[model samples]
Target: MTQQTAPCAVTERVIGIIAEVLDIPPHTITPETRVLRDLETESIDLLEFGVGLNAAFGIPVADDTVFLTSLRVHLEEARHADADPYKMMAGRYPHLSCDRVACILRTLDDGPVLSVQDIADYVLHALRAGQHEKAPSHAG
Candidate 1:
């Protein structure tokens, strides 16, 4: 696939992994589908999904990176520091779109609202970052 299509491939792969792990119909899973809400997934399902992502992409799926597991703590820190929650969250989760972070923050009580797109973005980020790290340096 070309560079333009790599993201689409990753998104589709993530959706497939989620559907397989959750035993849900792949047709029901979309980029905007919420893992917690729409998929009605539990903790074990998420764990297995993370494992699937790791195996499929050959990259370490850090809990925070893919799942945003520490979102509560991050929110607390951002509030304690009197920082802009949106900016803090955006920096913490570079893969998440700004609108997504805003939506999550708006529903602070409901906690982080992660979508399939976020997971795919994290996968793409991990893939690109891994490539950069593995690339041989020409500078001496």
Candidate 2:
């Protein structure tokens, strides 16, 4: 029999993976949990999380530095353009909403960090882009 996993289940498993990697109690982690501010996840921790996420979801996660660099480049270009940055991001990154782009911009301008929701959104985007596949099961 084929096992179908719901998206919420996948999100929960992602949260579980984050909790395990960070050695934090699962109850304390939420969608809004900030990897840096809330969990104090450093560069190494993010690297580990990226590996874990790839292993769990069968997705290729670019190294944290590469991901951040690309994001920063986009943000930098938007900042210099006359068009609204959030709108540009929404148009450029169709998977992400304008509000999400705004949040990412705010986080970039105020602090360099990403929330759990942001990571999940990236995963979803990758999935939609045909760059990832849902895990066979949650066992991972």
Candidate 3:
């Protein structure tokens, strides 16, 4: 029998971010480590990490529910089996890669309020923009 891996591959990524942000080596942090008690991470940092992670994975991390440990758990549960996971989420949420979403969300004092529709819109806009950016410029 083969061991089943978590659906989402955010564990290593999360650990990388935590290590970078906290200046704690990856070897030191574990799933059981409490951000506050064990890692001594402040609330602000934790929230910021959520926003950043959201952008990185194109997934929204609700401020109320965004905690380091919780984020890890949630990401681990995300299913990417569909042909278009982002599209599937459109009717509900505009899931952006954690990095992209988080970067945009971080700029807001509160939230980016992402939904699946918003993600579709952003993605469409991004694709259009990219096409235009890549178009060859002509001079008369």
Global fold similarity of model 2 (TM-score) = 0.74
Candidate 2 C-alpha lDDT tens digits along 1-140: 11213456556777887889889888899887776777767677777878887887678886643235366677678778766777766655555667767778776766655667767766666666677665657565
- Local error of candidate 3 at 4, Å? 15
Q: Per-prediction TM-score, please?
A: 0.83, 0.74, 0.42
lDDT of 1 by residue, 9-123 (tens): 9899999999898888899999988788777788888899888877777777777767888898988998999998888878889878787777877876764478899899898
What tens-digit string does per-residue lDDT give for candidate 3 at 1-140? 11111212344556666677788787886543445545657667766666555554445454543332333233334453423333333322333455544543354344233232232333233333342132233567
RMSD of each: 5.9, 3.8, 14.9
- Preferred candidate (TM-score higher): 2 or 3: 2
Report the poorest 10 consecutive residues by lDDT, candidate 2: 1-10
In order of TM-score, best first, we have 1, 2, 3
User: Which stretches in model 3 have alpha-carbon errors above 4 Å?
Assistant: 1-8, 68-140
Error of 1 at 5 (Å): 7.0
Alpha-carbon local distance difference test for all models: 0.81, 0.68, 0.44
Clashing pairs in 2: none
